[model samples]
Target chain A: MESHSGIAAVVKKTLNRRYRAERRFRRIGLAAVAVGLLFLAVLFTAIVSKGYTAFQQTHVLLDVYVDPDVVHVGNLDSADYQGLIKASLRELFPDVKGHRDKRNLYKLVSSGAGSILRQKVLEDTSLIGRRIQIWVPADDDVDMVIKGHVDRSLPESQRRLNNKSLAWVDALKEQGRLEKRWNLTFFTAGDSREPELAGIWGATVGSFYTLLITLSLSFPLGTAAAVYLEEFAPRNRWTDLLEVNINNLAAVPSIVFGLLGLAVFLNFFGLPRSSPLVGGLVLTLMTLPTIIIAGRAALQSVPPSIRDAALAVGASKMQAVFHHVLPLALPGMLTGTIIGMARALGETAPLLMVGMVAFIVDIPRGFTDAATALPVQIFLWADSPERAFVEKTSAAIMVLLGFLILMNGAAVFLRNRYERRW
Target chain B: MTTVGEIRAANPRMTCRQVNVYYGDKHAIKNVSIDIGRNEVLAMIGPSGCGKSTFLRCLNRMNDTIEGCRVTGTITLDGQDIYDPDLDVVLLRAQVGMVFQKPNPFPKSIYDNIAYGPKIHGLARTRSELDQIVETSLQKAGLWDEVKDRLKHPGTGLSGGQQQRLCIARAIAVSPEVILMDEPCSALDPIATARIEDLIHELREQYTIVIVTHSMQQAARVSQRTAFFHMGDLIEVGPTDRIFTRPRHSLTEDYITGRFG
Candidate 1:
């Protein structure tokens, strides 16, 4: 009786210990999940806090009266407007009497604002005699001060903008001369040398054209290759070799594709450098592997019985694929395509290797024209010495993130809508 | 049991001449020969791995899709060689449709599922014409009255029996000459199975039907001729009544009497 009681106690202890261990494991799993959620929350908060200030920008409202005599020179040629604007600005603040103050005021406005004014004058010759209220971009230091990047207590010698300039900015703000608009131009304007004036509009257009080219080329080619390889091609060494190469291509880094594009598109084919067309061809090579992999997976997920049923109904092999398999695989294929496009949009290394890093100041007129992408613009701004470029870089990053989120959201929507069950 | 020579006298639509099938090194079907006549329901019944389904798939060359599966010997339909290289597989499948063991209705509307084959084959030119094809096919599958109101609904949304009927309708939409059924009722409940068995009887009027069934009772109830396979060989095939009551081969006799699988 004593031995039997001892044995029962051991069994009870073992069972209790086992149950406790299981509970401990479950608690650890729950803790891990909670930690993951906390990490995501922290990341989101950081991105929002650092990136929110990028969307708003400060502009100096200048009421510069266009001097008719200077602007409308002998014959009033639109091309001479730039020189007239510079002459008028020089007359407004004579460099002799207020040389230092005038230079400080000039520094507050972006150096490229004169060029912008000139372009506007060229477009409309009648503005020479008019008193127009133009909102010129403020210099990077002034932009930083408005964004609270510069502390007021900093010494004049150490600060980018001195006390005198800061005083002038304060006066302008009090007089409602410095205003913050919605920054609509940031979304509509093109890339620029002046960080205060740079926008993602040009890069967005480039990305659009590139994605169009990728979709047009990759969709049909990828699907056809997948269908042939999955359904029609005989299982042999040759097909095996093809499958291996496809998998390897998917693993190859995007930069290699850039180099390949440089060699083939730029060197061999002599395509225009820095064109969206070349960028798109490079992106197509980068995206094809993903599309093919996804297409094959989608096609393979379809049950063999469906094919059997189609064949049984007297449908040919081609009929079975087109009539049954292709339609079913479309949703998954679309999700993959969207994912591939998102990856292409965020790709900077490949574009950098190709001539996307080139300084493109105008909006791309066509696929064959020079273009810039959002990430490339961010990289360019982040490298600039202007303090205003810091905000612009963050803003460009936000735009890039928004596009990525949109693409991924589309993928999720398509997946949820058309995902099928046997 | 009557020999293949005697069975040939009945004007068979399909004749398998000593057909053999191999999957890589394994002999799946050995010297199996059978004759199927028009409007006749022929049931091939045996235990698992007995080459019953293999022989049924051979009828439609569905085996062609499987890797490493090779068929030797001739299978002819109405005296036309089925394995000829020049034969269009699509046309052949259109003539000989199949319903799988598990109902595989395309993920499409009930109307569209039936319309798919007819549309692909250019069997119907206009919407009204396609609608007529869908209606006739569903009617033939014995599901038209029950589902006619919800024809626009997904075929996959149907119950098991209804989905199976939808697949049958999809098969019949192209107006195939022969319908091959591979364990079509195995995944269903007894009630669903009974409905499918009834539908099979109804389909025989328009199609030459061949079915692979695991249930002995189903074979007795629905088939006019029955083929019993054992160990990748056609052990015996004869009239349903004779094969069930007095199978000549010992293997067939043992299988029927439950002596062994």
Candidate 2:
């Protein structure tokens, strides 16, 4: 009886220990999941908060008399309109109690605002005859103050704009002279010297064209190569070597493809500098390895029995692959393609090597035209010394992240929709 | 009980003359010679790794898909050398189709699965003609009445036995003169296995059939001639009743009476 009781006690102790261990494991697993979720939440919150301020901008509204005499000067050469706009802006705020220095007053308007007004005048010469009230984008300091990026309590040495400028800005706000338009120009305009006026529309267009080129080139080439390798090619030493190279290519760093593109496309062939065509070519090389690897895996997932069934019916190997195997592998292939394209979309290093880092203010007209991608624009903005550019950089990053999430979501959706169980 | 010589005299559709198969350094098939008559069923029975299935794959050059597997000596169909390098493998396969151990229907509609072979070989030029071929193939496989109403459904959605019958229809759709089955009922339950056995008997009337079966009773019930393979060698080939009742090779006799594999 004593021995049996001792044995029963040990068994109960062991069972209790096992239960405790299981509970500990469950707690640790839940904790890990919570940690992962918290990390993602923090990253999203940080990005949205820092980036949201970029969309709103400050502007100075002025009803300036065109003064046909000043604009025309000696003749309507369209050149005099630029000086007239600058003179009008100076006259509008003459009696304002801001920094009385002429140079500081010039700082309130963006460095490139004169050129923007001149371009508008050049596009339409009839505007020279009328007195138009225009709301031009204010400089970065005024923009920061309106967006709450500026602190009025900071000393003049530490502050980006002085107290005198702040007083003038407050007076303008009180009189309803200062305005905050919907920033339609921020959507329509391209990159600018002032972060307050810079926009992503140009880079967005560039990304669109670059992806168009990448998709057009990579899909057919990658799928065809995969089909030939997986189906038609005989099992021989040369084909084996080819397969090894293809696998190795998939593992190679994407930046290496950029260097290769720099050497071959830009140097050897002399393609247009900083063009989406070159960026597309570089991205294609980077994406090819991914697409081919994915395509081959998709192709291999198709059972050999399907091929046999097709051939048993007198279908040739080509027919078997195209009609049967290709269809089955398509979902996987498309998922791979979308994933590869998303990778290309986020890539900045390769584009930098191919000169896509150049500042391109005009939107890309075609694949051959010079262009700057979103990430490259972000990089450029981040490197600027202007404090306002920091927010703009974060905003661009937000847009890029949004695109990546959308593309990956599409990949997951396609996988679930077309994935075959067999 | 008839001897191999007697079966050959009856009607030889496919004659294998001392065929050997090698996988790299391994001799997978020894000098195994047999004759399969037209419109008859021949079952090759053996323990696992005895080359019964390998021999069946050789009938249609299905073994070619396996790397390092080499076939030697002559296999003839109607006195024509099948191993000739110039012989078109696709056409050879069309002449001698195969049904795998597991049901491997194409991920397509049941009608498309049956129509695929005929469509690829240009057996049907029009939609109506292809439909006729699909119907006849299904009818031949004994699946017409059950599936005719839902022919557009995916072939993979069927039960295991139905999928196997669909594979049989897919093979027959090509109108091959010979059909090789490799353990075609191994994955099915007893009822499905019995249904497949019945289909095999019905199929023998139109094409020469060679089946690899693990079940001795299935062999005895379906085959007219049974070839027993031991260690990759054809130990005996004679009437099924003779191989089961009378002893020729000691190994064949031992295998039949369950002395040892």
Interface root mean square deviation per prediction: 1.6, 1.6
Evaluate residue A109 in candidate 2 and report its C-alpha lDDT on the 0 to 100 scale. Answer: 63
Q: Model 1: residues >4 Å from true position, as ranges?
A: A1-26, A33-39, A73-98, A115-134, B1-9, B122-132
What is candidate 1's CAPRI-style docking category based on DockQ?
A: medium
**Ten consecutive residues with minimal summed lDDT in candidate 1 chain B?**
B1-10
lDDT of 2 by residue, B1-261 (tens): 122323352678899877899999999888767778998899899899999999898988878878889999889888878899888888988999899999999888999888878877889989999999999999999899989999999989999999999999989988999999999999999999999999999988889999999999999999988988877877778888888888587788788888876
For residues A89-197, could you state the per-residue lDDT of candidate 2 as single tens digits?
Answer: 5676676444455556666766656666666666666777687776677888888887887777877999877876677678668877777667666667688876776
- Residue A199 in model 2: shift from native, Å? 1.4
Least well predicted 10-residue stretch by lDDT in candidate 1 chain A: A88-97
Q: How well does candidate 1 score on lDDT at residue A300? A: 90
